[model samples]
Target: MATPHTIAVAGKGGVGKTTTCGMIIDYLCSKKTGPVLVVDADANSNLNEVLGVEVETSLGAIREEMAQAELKGTIPSGMTKADYADFKFSSAIVEEDEFDLLVMGRTQGKGCYCYVNGVLKSQVDKYAKNYSYIVMDNEAGLEHVARGTLPHVDTMLLISDCSRRGVQAAARIAEMIGEMELKPGKMGIIINRAPNGELDSGVKAEIGKHGLELLGVLPQDEAVYRCDCDGEPSSKLPQSNPVKQALKGIMQELGL
Candidate 1:
């Protein structure tokens, strides 16, 4: 088990990916075992909402400086861009109980974020080594890591709704993974908002074609919706909630 250092959660929008990520974080925190780092790589910035953290810092500002550093080549002679990039990591990290979070807010311009996002890759890769588990709430797609921004992860959880579009999106993401050659330890599907029953024939077949393990499914739960409306943290979801129980199955299946 190659350390299982980092886990990236990705999927189509409205797939409850962020909520799933939060549940994973909750599971990690329950253990008296290790530190958990939550990385929010979504431009929409909802991981903070799921985790119930009012984010005060983000990777955006440091990206501005790294952009300047890369363009000017003024990072103290002999230090590689990656070496100078470490400082940005220290400054960018935001710590909290049981973990820290690094939120990648929106990118402003049309130009690429190559300079800083590149630096972020190595920085996060190094930071990952220190912890037992790292949970990333990735974007709608995985273009960031595919383009070499976020670090190589262990398991990539592509959460999807129980819909044809979700199934198709999962297939496309698997293709993207191959094209990028980001050989994660494993990749799988977490079907959210699906009824707890035998997998639908078409759904099983679609998932089969991709060779992705059906990690688990979270049935539609009003607990989630009601709580969300009230701004309650997913991690603190009541034990009676079906969503929490479903997520427990997910983590157990993954051996988290």
Candidate 2:
């Protein structure tokens, strides 16, 4: 089977990373790019809300259950613990028409998570071959990257707002990628919520100083804000929405 094209989206909090990641997933699915796998690796885990999907379970929850299952005697007879874990992990995937979402939920109530994390990685690797693309919304801390958990990254999109601090945070992430030697096929920055889709001179200077590539800019669009306020999915935004259009163009430029 062919390997999936993996895309990792990362940024500091409040930079609209999840929203932009949702738009990318929606665009890929809408364009019929092929089956996509969406991974919400962010601990806060709101990618589903942006995509208008509901998730009842997560890998973290399954891990916790498995941690205590032996004591509780929940593993069915004739099923190995690994087999039971596989079954539970499969149930955590939230299947949608366009994509399947796997949320790496936050660890709870403290215990060594290494075993479950290994299982989750194995499951992701198994499922990855069945998709054309895998889009991940990562937390600002790059926990997956630090742990070397992602199967591989084809493209890394670092999201940032117009603020200097946001750009600096993105630059730091870029630096971490280099330090970790996780050389993705491509890496660039997408400046979101830019007023009129234009960057200030200082921000431009900062980008140049950090040597970060500016993939594209998404203008501040009230439509996106309105959708959030109305409890609607960002994918529900009209085709004319500037943010959507800008993301489409960015994806096209990347040959996605």
Candidate 3:
């Protein structure tokens, strides 16, 4: 089977990265470029909240359980430890009509996470080919990508919130990706929640200095905030919402 076109979204917190990731998934599914796999690789996973989906389990939660079981030497009869772990991992994938979400629930603590991350990478590698698009909403930084725990990325979209610090944070992520030599097919910076889906000269200059391409700007829309406040799905935003429209343009520019 052919591999899916993977798009990984990364940025500092509070930059609207998760919301934009949701928008990318929504846009792709709307275009019938599914079945899309949405990986909430963020430790503080809230992608489901934005998508209005429920998750019963997460990779981290089950990893802890399996590891503890192994420590206690309680691998069930007739089932290898690997098989039991795989079963739990499969259950972590929450199915939805338009997409499937696999969340990396909590932050890693002390001790090596190699075994769990290894299983995650193995499972992702195994199942990724079934989808046409895999959109990963990563954590605030480049930890997962830098560790090389996830599947290969086709494109990486770095998001900023039209602030100088936010842009610099995105630039740092881009720099880290370069230093690590992950070499995604396409990499670009997106200015999110901008005043009018437009960037001023100063922000453009800052982005240029980092050698990052400005794919497009997403305008601020109060409707998005209202939805968040009301605990509603971002995908439920009206077609006329500026943020939604801007994201559509951005996706088009990226040729997604």
TM-score of each: 0.85, 0.96, 0.94
State how far residue 151 of model 2 sits from its true place (Å): 2.2
lDDT of each: 0.77, 0.88, 0.85
> How do the residues 127-147 of candidate 2 rate in per-residue lDDT, one tens digit apiece?
999999999988888877877
Model 2 — TM-score against the truth?
0.96
Top of the candidates by TM-score: 2
Report the C-alpha lDDT of model 1 over 65-85, residue by residue, as the tens digit.
Answer: 777788887678888876776
Task: Select the stronger candidate by TM-score from 2 and 3.
Answer: 2
**Model number with the top lDDT:** 2
Ranking by lDDT: 2, 3, 1
Q: Which stretches of candidate 3 lie above 4 Å from their native place?
A: 107-112
Candidate 1 differs from the real structure by a C-alpha RMSD in angstroms, to one decimal, of 3.4
Residue pairs with colliding backbones in model 1 are none
Candidate 3 lDDT over 1-256, as tens digits, reads 8889999988998899899988888888889956999998887789999899988888888888887888998878899987898888899999888998888776257756566666667878888988999999888876777788867898899999898888899999988888875789999999988886678778888998888899889888888888899999987677677888888987887788
RMSD of each: 3.4, 1.3, 1.6
